[model samples]
Target: MKKNLFIGALTLTAAPIFAQQAVQRPNIIFIMSDDHASQAISAYGHPLSKLAPTPNIDRIAKNGAQFWNNYCANSLSGPSRASILTGKHSHKNGYLANWNKEFDGSQQTLPKILQENGYETAIIGKWHLISEPTGFDHWMILDGQGDYNNPDFITDNDTVQYFGYVTDLITTFTKQWLQTRDRDRPFFLMMHHKAPHRNWVPAERHYNLYEETEFPVPENYFDEYEGRFAAKNQEMNIYRDMYEGHDLKMVTGIDSDTLLFDPWPDAFINTLTPYEKKRFFEAYRSRNNDYYNTDLTEKEIALWKLQRYLQDYLATIKSVDESVGQILDFLEQSGLDENTIVIYTSDQGFYTGEHGWFDKRFMYEESFQMPMVMQFKGEIKPGTQVHGLTQNIDFAPTFLDFCGIKIPEDMQGESFREMVVSGSTPEDWRQSLYYHYYEYPGIHSVRAHYGVKTDRYKLIYFYDEDIWELFDLENDPTEMKNIFGEEGKENITEELKKELSRLQKLYEVPGI
Candidate 1:
């Protein structure tokens, strides 16, 4: 088995803030889930809002502000995570893709900066950066693409397999760590969860949730990919790309050796102990049997997969919601709520059959946008919402800002602390957001591309394919029609290109 473990020396920076201030510093708990889409959370009010609601995640919105225009600098897990950690784009951070790349732990990161400035820092759960975690006092994480049930965790001491659902196990470790952490000093905790990722395994308790619920198929679920070449070329289409026995978790009896198509790996299931395997396999036996016994047309199969996909995906999220509620309850009961900054977000947005897709890579809204909510009791106004464009790059700076620490000059993202405190958009805030994705010759076959998204329009360039696509988001929110060369769109296209060029230069990224 390939090991994804990195251990490094711990370096402490000067405790600049602690030396200057006598006031109590705020405690921060950033909770992130893997591949969680905005539409899946009811707080975003997407098409599936009514069918599956996230009450616990909504609590953060109800109590604080919900950022509707939040996004990831890069849609892939490792790249986005690297951006969040170092407050720089993938190019500067040197973690451009998920596979065969490890984060440069020697570089300054949020946890390191905070730890240097007199805050106790710890991270538990999915740390996919692939480097020995540095700057943290305590850190525990799962191996790459951790299993959903009874996952193994890598800590500073050793790798141990914990019994229970992965989501529940992550929360258990988080709570346990919080309970024993130094209470006198303020601390920062990254409680990351690996739920709702690929394979979409739910806890046995939530296995049946949404099973009877039929999801509203996205309007573009059967997208013909009329204009965009990249969309047409992707390997993530719902009907053609998703694997039967793996992605949908249906037990297709076709032997890998006999079948022409490659089989999904059962390594995750193989990791389970005898009893764990028995209970888990038995729970899905009837469902798998039912799926294999049925026959359907292409469209029917697509719709069936959509339903199955959402049920399992949302069921996993249900556990994450419960975990959020448990954390909130702990904060309130322990009096930490009064001074803590609680944030709920995801690594990146995912596609729930949007544009006939199941993964995130495209510059489309469904894949590029992320769900973010933050509550800082008595500091930020309750029920406030911000429409300003924020990216994952801003996270590190924002945390440093809240701690009253001077953000490092090399950090590329600006802190949104002022806007959160004022409950209004800053007059000088950015008007357009820049995005780039580069993992080609990689999975899903999403070509390397970059784009800029403004409130009214978007322009993407598939540099490798040398194709330009533009959309008037105000009119074509689904982005079904590409209007790059349309007669009246020339000026808008030119304007977007100008902004994109400026952003690339400003961020020091390679120009188009």
Candidate 2:
């Protein structure tokens, strides 16, 4: 009888430990915003960013660590997101560019690994990856750059259009899923936003938020493209190439004067006096319709470009911030805040009139950097800033690390959990980061190039041109001065070449 009582006591003692271990698994909520740049958010301290402050995005940084040097392996939407999911570069994953490439769902991903470890996974929002999202228990995604107003969502069963704005609708589904999902198991939810993308449409509520003020321009807005041949021919120029078709058109009625002018009949205009009709024709001409007939003199026209750009961009971001607040609020109300890991980031950085360019696909700092911030309530130390070299490829391993799942050997990135949890970055980490930009002569006239970025210097090789460009980042942060092929930097250039070659071979890149 004594033996039986002792056995029961032993079992009771072990029960609490087992229950504690089971409950320790954290819920992960990864929020990704399309085409969002660190420059747009006030948290990053861009001089022109006060126009639309991303307070909700700032909230994540305020509560946890914001990575100062986070970057994407490739600087396009689909390719960058693919790297995040697979923890592999575009070349390794077979998704180098945006054309005709689909994410193969059969490969190992965070969702699949988390699901295998007994977590309920649901992805609600923009899944730009071409394949049907595999390994997700429940998924409702947008069908290829979903509309801002009355967007359509593709569910596991069928495609359905939901009324209201895309950002609000995505958040509605996220909240609904949180309420309906199984409560016994932890959840991994991806709330992706399609706002602040091309054609920059803002919701009705944010339409008039920044209408009165003019946004300031970056110092490099009028870059002359002196040393860089690729910068001379980019397609994202606002003044030269932005059109009224497709994404840029406003839903509101376009002004008649903005339309292409048709030559008036000879008989009709002969009767009108030259002086009386001079003002009328001038007002109605397409050339004068560029700035909505505002008195933007030549000097102001330069400033007006940045103003119009930010007004539309910030307006879209305003709605995105509101949606982020809603998600954070829902987590708090559901008592999931303590156990949930919230991450806010963009697929890639964007240009806000920097270097006279707007789109990505260059290894330049503006296009290469991505805003990465995360908050794990109890697991990660609050208000930590990590300066370690982290990439989108590191995201998959980090997620798996949080869930205590085994990271597959094939994955290319190492988990940064130790850096986040302990608040101490590792020394002698990656001395340099490998970069590649494949989309060439497509949208941005940037040539296909691969490069290496060390702490102080950068070396780029434009394969098509067979030209190499090197920049001393410490001396010229704006990348204005190219020290490559210059006198007295030969030894430094040679050393960087050897380091770049070593990295290419270490990463198993072919034909280094």
Candidate 3:
């Protein structure tokens, strides 16, 4: 009888251990928003955030950690996404620009690593990097800069046009994949949204949101580019020179005599409504009257222009927020919420009249910082906040690490899993971040600049112009003043320059 009791006790002890071993591996869902600025999310505390509340994005912050200081390797879409995929910089991936570049999928990527480790991988929505997605077992991607409405999707089967909002279609595909994917194995899914980019057009449902509200102007909305040569030539300003080129098919309500030649064909005029038609003609007529014929006031035309721009831009963001909500709902209904890791971020930051600029590619805080948040459900403690410097390249390795997969030795990024899952902050953390913006004199008048941003100061070097711009971030957070050549700050500038040089050498930057 004593022998029987001993065997029964052993069986009881082993039961829980067996149950633990039977638990399934977690799912990973990564979502990306194009040109989404950190300031746009209420969780980040921008003054103008009340204009459009991102409750769904804030939901992730409430359920997980909101990374306060996350930045991108290169502040552009293709390069930043490439950095996240390959765990390398633009120089390594060889995709530095939006035009005529192809991404090589042979490189080690998080998805491929996960797939090798028994995880099923799928990607839907924008895959701007010029290559067939490699690591993914399944993928349905937009050709490039996907249309906001009735977007074209290249699936594993064929290229098909889906007649709906881009965000909705992408979310729908993600949900359908989740429903039909192999349930036995874990999965990694990327749902990338193409909304909120240029020519911001929302779905029919989000057309009139924030329509009655007037967005407050940013403090530096009228930046004069004083003390900074690079800022003087940016092509992102909305007022004076922010017209869409021939490629984008923009129909401004302004008159022909005062406007530059239309880059679009006459067929585009058919899309205008009777009221829109009246406004378009009046704008051109007013421009001709004010400048060429002398009739209407400049102030009237400026007000009209602001109204037209805001209507389209805010509408796009509304659709993005709605789509985020839909994905969250799917997670909850599928019983995958408790075991899934959800990440929401953007390729780069964008300007909404910040510094009177409307695009990214600058080291300025608005364009440099990106919105990043992650929710690992029960695995990570909710409402956690991390202030450590996180880069875009870190994403690939972090995902690999979470799945217990081996990160490729060629990947330069370090996993932030310790900081995220264990809440352990490292002592040897980086004191500064290195940034490089190569696209210059193309879209934004931003010059090619490389810089190092510390907690208190920022030093930027414009290589072609042989110019250095330094800002005491603690004193002048707005970056209005350049103190690189100022008296008494010479030592600080010199030290920062050395630090910058050290980082460039450490990163093996060739031209620096």
Q: What is the lDDT of candidate 2?
A: 0.79
> How accurate locally is residue 84 in candidate 1, as Cα lDDT from 0 to 100?
90
- Name the runs in model 2 displaced over 4 angstroms: 1-21, 244-292, 295-302
What tens-digit string does per-residue lDDT give for candidate 3 at 1-512? 99968875776587755334224567889999898878678788785567778889888888998988788877888888888888887777777766536887887778888887778899999999877899899999997777776667997789997766688888889889999997656889998999778766556565556556677766776688799998887777776665542212233344452224344323223334455445544533532334434344665444434544555576677777777888888888977888889999999888777777677898877788878889997778988888888888889888878777777887877889888876656888678888888886566667888899987899999999999999998899889999998999989989999999998877778866
lDDT of 2 by residue, 1-512 (tens): 99968875776586866446547998899999999888888888886677678888888888888888888898998888888878988877878888746888888788888888878998998988888999899999998877776667999899997767788898889999999987657888888899788767677666557767667777777788788766675677765555432323321223442223213222122323465235334432333345565666755755565566677788888888899889898888978888889999999999888876677888888889898889989777778888888889899999999888999988888898888777777885676788888887676566888999888899989888887889998998888777889999999899999988987877788755
Worst 10 residues of 3 by lDDT: 245-254
Better of 1 and 2 by lDDT: 1
Error of 1 at 13 (Å): 26
Which pairs clash in model 3?
234-445, 235-445, 254-284, 255-283, 255-284, 289-294, 289-295
| Rank by lDDT (best first) | 1, 2, 3
The sequence of per-residue lDDT tens digits that candidate 1 reaches over residues 298-400 is 7787899899888989999999999999999999999989989999999999999888899898889988999999999888999989888899999999999
Candidate order, TM-score descending: 1, 2, 3
- RMSD of every candidate to native, in Å, equals 6.2, 8.7, 6.9
Q: After superposition, how far is residue 287 of candidate 3 from its true place, in Å?
A: 18
Which prediction has the highest lDDT against the true structure? 1
